[model samples]
Target: MAYLNKLRLFIRKPFSGLCDFNRATTAQCRKPLPIWLRRDIPPAGKIKRVKGILAELNLQTVCVSARCPNLPECFSKGTATFMIMGDSCTRACKFCAIKKGKPAPLRADEPQAVAQAAQRLGLSHVVITSVTRDDLPLGGAEHFAKTIRAVQNQLPHATIEVLTPDFQGNLDAIKTVIQAKPDVFNHNVETVPRLYPSVRPGANYARSLAVLSYTKDFAEKAGKRIIIKSGLMLGLGERRKEVLSVMRDLRSVGCDVLTIGQYLAPSPNHHPIVNFVEPEEFEQYHQEGLKMGFLAVASGPIGVKLRQHCHCYGQTAP
Candidate 1:
């Protein structure tokens, strides 16, 4: 069946380009995943229970939407990163697995639904994220703030973390989320600046950095010691120097935590993986980040999702 599919693809393209494309795909398939990337699927019962609960509440999770490899493990533990503002994203990033198109109208009940789900799961640390809603005037910042407040109302003791979009560099929108007083604020830069045109076409590198800088500044001026976090994915054809430069850029903005992980292309149609960065390379970045004064760094092949390391800086912070 796979061979037939390849043959069909070959027939659809010019013969000269077909050979090169087939060779690249074949080579990619031949290369086995690194040992560190392998996983043992967790018990289905626990995963099913978590999914059933989410289904009952009509809550969407980036875990399920993004096809995260860590889903089963995280679900078995009864935790999820709630994806608010609906499942459809406004931006069409090449690497993300989330669906892209016109999204549904913002749901007024989603905030309470997310809060109830977190309380039912008894989550001590809650991570809230959303699809890019560029259509909205404030880019869904108010919705994010409402979700944070709802969760706070239901679980007063739980620490809230929000991974937000750039909001098109709107400082007012950024301030809306910051004023909510989330314990941690995360905005993933996702990749090096050079790759932005191809990797994250809808996003601007400078705008992303500015978003982080403004969030850090606004929160501090408000007398809130909120942790500012950002992340990048390696293996997107980014050079080591570029990766380090991004780290420096984040540090310049007072980013408190950094999450670096190998990029796994969601599909062949997405950005092709240029490399499978080694565990040793990840460790080198981890050590370099610590030396550069990052409060905490999570760098590795797997289990490197931002949510997994939400509390890392807290543990290391004074």
Candidate 2:
């Protein structure tokens, strides 16, 4: 019966002006954003400067591709997480705003282009992520290695963090990226296990966890001290206990860092927000995560605001 109800909700058309997916839309399923979730508009001048640099380099950022609400603020602050592979993603995750289709052929110059952009931005901490490129052999692990090396060559003092895909649980692929020696290796599980089929149909929760576990073991074996990080989105109909269970699972796998944030529905066509998790709830989760042994926990509306929030309270190897 519950399954049938979900099926009905999927088929139903969203109501009125609040329903448009292509343009700005409102939360059709939940109430308006709370005061804490509301953010200030970024400075126009700073935004333009960042955009100009990204455009010149022909680079993609998860900030723009995922329609992150924090884009203006991140860009205005002169930091952007470079999306390396391409703009198109192979997996059609219901909650993502990135277009899903045949991604363009891997640009051989991307490594250098990304390095150039980082140089132009004068970034001291560079975060690199990519669309899930399942079409590529080794799940684009080699490309990730190349990009990491390129960034290191350009900015020897800067810290490099990578938010990567699961590589279909291929240990060899995981090893390839770990060997690149990024300061932090991150892979988001996205949501609780029960919501995986509906929210992330193309991904497997166990496979994602395995990828983190193997990366941790591989890094330790190589005598490398790399931070293992993961993120989760709330307001996806997940119960409090379920959220804690996910945190425990992450800690079990030796994940050093965790990020929890509100899951804003990118469009009306995307997964509907089940509830707006309160600021207090996020704080509660943060406290619980620390107790569960995460070296650092970033939670709340701007939780995984990656570059800024991630480095706070975590021990990074020098």
Candidate 3:
């Protein structure tokens, strides 16, 4: 059956962690990049400058840790989505490229380091995300709050956005971050309900939805104007109706922003990309999302996740 076939693939390839994931697979690595997803190679000097600063500050970014296709371009522009709470993740999400295993001890200085990096980069808007640290008591929620406060203290005028883990859907943990008052609070459901078991085994579909719902309610009661946001990765064999249903669910919970992007498998060991979604279809989703009441929508094959519209509300996307 399917399980036996997958077992055979595992035995054959063994996922040595050396395979290039930006391409589909070793056998298909030479295939040309899709026309819709292609990008101009970025200049190295600006990218190097950003990387040097991050290195000096001992900061990490999701751009590097997750092998984002937009890294070169984002770096050249001196923008990075900072990744805190260590590089390793406790959960083994099959779709993500981040190393899945025991994470190192949390760095007590990381919060201030991220603020310093943001200040050095001269960023007007900052995004901070983390690898899932399920081993921690509050799932690194307090660390998140501290980092937000640090950034706020260092760059009082800058807008802060946090893409956080579900904290196993702990209401107290969710409240802890909400109380920090990030301008935007985001937690991606990542995919449809049916694909949860395969794509994100450790994440619960309903629980993820509740994280957004509760944050919105909590922030409202606290009288904070925090925007609740979520996103999805398409082309994992998801049906169009299923994607729409996910959007409806997000709207029901008052999600204010949405990002839809194509799923790129990190390596042969990861889940394979079912198909590349079309540019026109991305446009359709973009329009549909706007109609669904999202304050902003960024849907495309390339740079969807990094688009400025995904970062803050009411800003014209570059």
> Least accurate stretch of 10 residues (summed lDDT) in model 3?
12-21
TM-scores of all candidate predictions against the true structure = 0.87, 0.87, 0.88
Model 2: worst 10 consecutive residues (lDDT sum) = 13-22
Alpha-carbon local distance difference test for all models: 0.78, 0.77, 0.78
Q: RMSD of each candidate?
A: 12.6, 10.7, 10.8
lDDT tens digits by residue: candidate 1, 1-318: 442332222222211100101112222333467777777888998889889989999999888787776676778888888999999999989878789999999989999999999999988778898999999988999999999999999999777889898999999999999998887788989899999999899999999999999988888788877878788888889999999999999999999777787777666778888888998898889878877877667777666533322223233211
Evaluate model 3: give its TM-score: 0.88
Steric clash count of candidate 1: 0
- Taking the tens digit of each residue's C-alpha lDDT, what string does model 2 give over 84-154? 89999999988888899999999999999999999999987788999999999999999999999999999
* Alpha carbon deviation, residue 15, candidate 1 (Å): 47
Please list the residue runs of candidate 2 whose C-alpha ends up more than 4 Å from where it truly belongs after superposition.
1-31, 303-318
